[model samples]
Target chain A: MNAIEIKNLNKSYQNGLKALENINLSVKKGEIFALLGPNGAGKSTLINIICGITKKSSGQIRVFGRDNEADYKKTRSMIGLVPQEIATDSFERVINTLRFSRGLFNKPSSDRYLDSVLNSLELSHKKSNQIRTLSGGMKRRVMIAKALSHEPNILFLDEPTAGVDVALRKTLWSYLNNLKKQGVTIFLTTHYIEEAENIADRIGVINNGKIIIIEYKKKLLKKFGEKKLIFTINRKNKSINTINSIIKKYELKQKGNKITFNYTQNSKKDPASDLLSELNKRSIRFQDLEIKKNNLEEIFINLVQK
Target chain B: MNIRGIKAIYNFEMSRTFRTITQSIASPVLSTILYFIVFGSAIGSRINDIDGLNYSSFLVPGLVMLTILNQSISNSSFGIYFPKFSGTIYEILSAPISPFEITCGYVLAAASKSVLVGIIILATSSFFIELSIIHPFWMIFLLILISLTFSLFGFIIGIWADDFQKIQLIPSFIITPLTFLGGSFYSINMLPEFWQKVSYFNPIVYLVSAFRWSFYGNSDVNIKISIFAIFFFLGLCLVLISMIFRSGYKIKT
Candidate 1:
């Protein structure tokens, strides 16, 4: 069974503003799904609704074949959420807070499991220290530890790396990788395409409360990634006629002494090597040669812009 | 239904009380003692007695009630408001715990703290003034009742308020003033007949009168009426709390 299934989800505010319009998506078990969106996108609203923090205007959400509202207790018990905000009671000691949260779910007190969670997050040493005394990164990790203290099967990270330093971000990346290996399905929403590109098995793009596209990361790259070849020719005006011919043949663009060609990986052999040989025969002595493929950011921009 | 959920929330809230011992317990206890020193002794030396009781002794129940009212409102309001301000409330909202359980956890913790503060203030008053609660059972009942009621009120104010200033506005401007004028320091009989009727409009007057009656077996208001007022306010606060949760007020997304 899929870890989560959402159907025809719609959320409209009291002011008659539609925050989510018929959002339908599913996350496979033991797979990492990254939801990429802009600032005002409905990423958070959808996550919050699934987590039972926000009510849906009209929709059906099922986790493990159980209706979210009908079996809220069982559903909530199986999922953990790492919110985007760094929120913890400053004065309370870290260990005590985690224990209390574990108890909240009516889970039996298992210090062994709690300790393992803390150790995994690198927070075991600071367990007895007050949360306020910890740095921002530590506190964020504590939030993660608290969420995991209950030992849920599925975890939802709502912009987990937001405002985090590079080091913590890398740590969190490996830690999440470990969770995925343990068969924990991860549903992540993030603005950082690089983070998603690094971790997400499948990418879902949402824009203005609509799910624009959802596809495998590799497939998305293969389909939308535009490969570019550029060369700098010393003599621009001399090569104008040859450059025009190449532009017509390969659909390239020229700016000053630079010529750019776009191609796909679908072609056999090297698509740009023949063009390179052609340029050599024409005596366009270009020293600077570069090949660039469109990153996830470009793909994301192209999808959202379209 | 989720008793463990309620317990977790309750214990977490109560831990904050011990963590900030000075702010939560000591400050109020010390202030209550100072109230006795200034109002009980300094003013007692001038006026002989009121309602056939020593002035210092007569202030005991009123002072205890005053502390409970302030403590109950302040504790519960801050208990919920701090989480909302810091954004930790999302965890509670997302949990399997129902809204009723959430309210039970926070309101119970706040009430218990207020009750403890009331008991401590009562013990403190006994040091300087010779006292006897003629109806000890009634006194305990009223203490718990007032604490629970005001704590719920504080919870409402916490959810109603959107910012720091508003959290403190009602308790300072409305509750404290009403308590002071509700015959905390003196009998309402000292005022004219019209003022006595005006004092009846304040809910604190009924609480103080009922509590004072349990102390001396005499009160400005009838015992039955006082009991009715407490239950009435308690019922209203409970309904308001349920409505607040249903409406998904400031706490929900």
Candidate 2:
């Protein structure tokens, strides 16, 4: 069964600003789905709607095949949400926060489970300490502990590492990957494209309250991925017009003594190979040749710009 | 019926109360004793008795009701408002617990705090004045009922308020004045005939009169009318809270 299914979901604020538009999405069980978007792109709004924090203007949502609104208790019980803000009771003890969250979900008291969650997050030592006394990164980990306290089947993290240092962010990514291995479906939104590249099984890009694209990490990379072939020409004696034909045909760019050609990596035509031979046939000599593959960050920028 | 969910919020609020014990318990107890020393001696000297009851003894029930009313409203309001201000309310809203369960948790915790304070005030007053309860059962019943009602009312205020000042606004400006004018230190009979009629319009008058009757077996308002007034207010608070939850007002949105 799908971990989450949202269809025809639309949300608009009272001021008539549309927050989400016809959002149709599904996250498979036990897979990590990362939503990538710039600020004000409705990524958090969508997650909040699914977690039952923000009321949807109109929509249908199902968690494990049950309508989320109609069966809120069942749906919400199956999900754990780590919100974007690190908002916690400052004076509350770490262990007590976990206990409170676990109890709020109506789960039976299980010190064993709570203790394990604390240990896994490296917060066992700080369990008795007040939340305010913890470092910023540790406090964030505490938020994760609270979300996991209920032992939910699905987890939603909104900008989980927005302000963490690189090393701590990597640790969080590893922890999330471990949860995914445990058969927990993980859904998250992030501004860091590499975060998604490293951990997400599937990636969805949203912009202006609309989902621009959603695809598997490998497939999305192959589909939009581009390769650039650059040739430094020894055009000392050859007519510049001789290379104009190749430039016009392959839509290449010429700068000084170098000509550049761009094409998708997965395309049927091997434009790089064809252009190399054409350069030889035309007697357009070259000193050096280099090929480069565009990364996900470039593709994301291209997609959002489009 | 998320009993554990209710218990979680209840424990959380109660722990906060204990954490600020000086403010929650000590401050009120001190104020109640001061009221006795000052009013019991200063005003007790001026007014000897009212309707055959010693002036100092007569202040007990009204004083208890005053503490319950103010503490109940402030405790519950601050309980819910702090979560909103700190942004932790998102966790509660997203949890599996229903609105009814959430209400029960906060209101019960607030009422429990106020009731405890009320009892302590009564005990302390006994040291200074010869306090008696003609109907201990009714006194206890009225104490709980009043606490629950005002706590629920304060819950509404917490939801309605956007800033910290607004949370204190209603309890300070509305509740405290009504209690003072409702015969907390003096019976409404001391007022002229027209002023007595005006005092009956204040809901706190009904609460204090019934509470006083439980202690002295005498009251300015009919016992049945006071009881009905309390239930009516309780119903009003419940309806307002239900509407707030249903509409996803300040808390959910």
Candidate 3:
């Protein structure tokens, strides 16, 4: 059974705003699932509902095959959340906060474990310092430490690296990957395509309060991901016009001095070879040729636009 | 609902609350001194005794209760409000901690502060006035009960308020006016018959009268009625706070 099963979830605020609608998703145990969306795509709302932080208007949500509402305590004990916004009480010390968070989960107080979590997040040195004294990046790490203190089975990181610097972001990603290796299911929501592309086993794109698609990362890329081939000519030969004519014959777009050919894996014909043959036949000389595969960002934009 | 969780939250909140020792202890002491000097020495001396106790002595219980009520309200309200304002409430809300545990921790912390402030003011008043404890146990009990009651009220206010200004509104608009009119400075008998009847409606009057009864063994209102009023208000606050937690009011939605 999936670690988390959400079926036909719906949520609407009291203000009559529909935050999520008809969403369905199932996350396998120990898999990194990346939920991607724009600013108002309801990613946080979905996470909030599953964590029991927010009430859902309609849905069937199960954690570890147990109904969330029926076994709320057990479900809550199994999950840890690192919110998108940094949320450590400014007056709290790092170590004490983590200890309290662990206790909140009814976990036995283990100073050694708390130390390890703080050390893992590089917060041990500042453990005694008040949270208000820390910089933004440090505070972010403190949040991670607090979440991991309880040693939950499933962890949700909502934009964990949103405003963090590059080095810290990479460090956090590495730490999160290590947590995933420990048999913890990770649900991450991020606007960073590279972060998802590197770590996510499965990707779910949400837009307009709906799940646009959910598929294996590689499979989704192979199916909907497009590739573009661009050629820069050595000279403005008359054959360039012939090349444009050939591309037009195949329903491609061409502008002054450049032509772009877009294709997917299931194209009727191999556009690359066809274009090369056409260029060869026309004696079109080119200085350089490049083929670029579409990234997740482009795919996300395309899906959202559609 | 979870005992261990409540304990943990309580410990954490209490420790943080007491971290700033000077501000937590000294500020309230200074404020109480000013109150005794201005109200007790100046205004209180000119005013005749009520219920056979000197004006300064009469003001002691009320002043102590005032400190408890004010500090209790501010501490809890600020405890929750600061987290909400700084976005740290999201962290706690997202954690495995239940809302009940969260409420218990914050309210306990606020109550602890109120108790501390109450004790400090009581000790300070000993220097200026002949402060006596007619029933030490009852005095302690009433102090704690009043502190807990107000702290819970403050917790509800904290959850209901969205911003800092809103948090302060409770103390400024509601708590202060109720306290002043509740016979903190004067007895209800000093007021006209119509106003005296109206004074009984304010809840703070009960707390003040009960606390004074414990201190001086005399009260303007019936001791049993004051006790009932306090416990009833406490129950009401608890019920409302529990409902807010169960419904996942502002904290979740």
Q: DockQ of all candidates, in order?
A: 0.61, 0.88, 0.51
Using lDDT, give the best candidate's number. 2
Better DockQ candidate (1, 3):
1
B229: Cα error in model 1, Å: 1.4
lDDT of 3 at A253: 64
Query: RMSD of each candidate?
Result: 2.9, 1.5, 2.9
* Share of the reference A-B contacts seen in candidate 1: 0.68
Per-residue lDDT for B91-201 in model 3, tens only? 566555666778878888889888988887888999998778998999999999899989998988888999888989989998899998998888888999999999988
Task: Candidate 3: give the clashing pairs.
Answer: A87-B88
Q: Looking at candidate 1, what is the lDDT of residue A289?
A: 88
Name the best candidate (by DockQ): 2
Q: Any runs in candidate 2 off by more than 4 Å, and if so which?
A: A234-241, A281-285
Interface RMSD of each: 1.1, 0.7, 2.0
Q: Which of 1 and 3 is the better model by lDDT?
A: 1
User: Residue A200 in model 1: shift from native, Å?
Assistant: 0.8
The share of true interface contacts that also appear in candidate 3 amounts to: 0.62
> Which portions of model 1 miss their true places by more than 4 Å?
A229-246, A254-259, A267-291
Give the per-residue lDDT of model 2 (tens digit) for B78-156: 9899999998998998899999999999999999999999999999998997778999999999999999999999999
Q: How accurate locally is residue A52 in candidate 2, as Cα lDDT from 0 to 100? A: 88
The CA lDDT of each predicted structure is 0.90, 0.93, 0.86
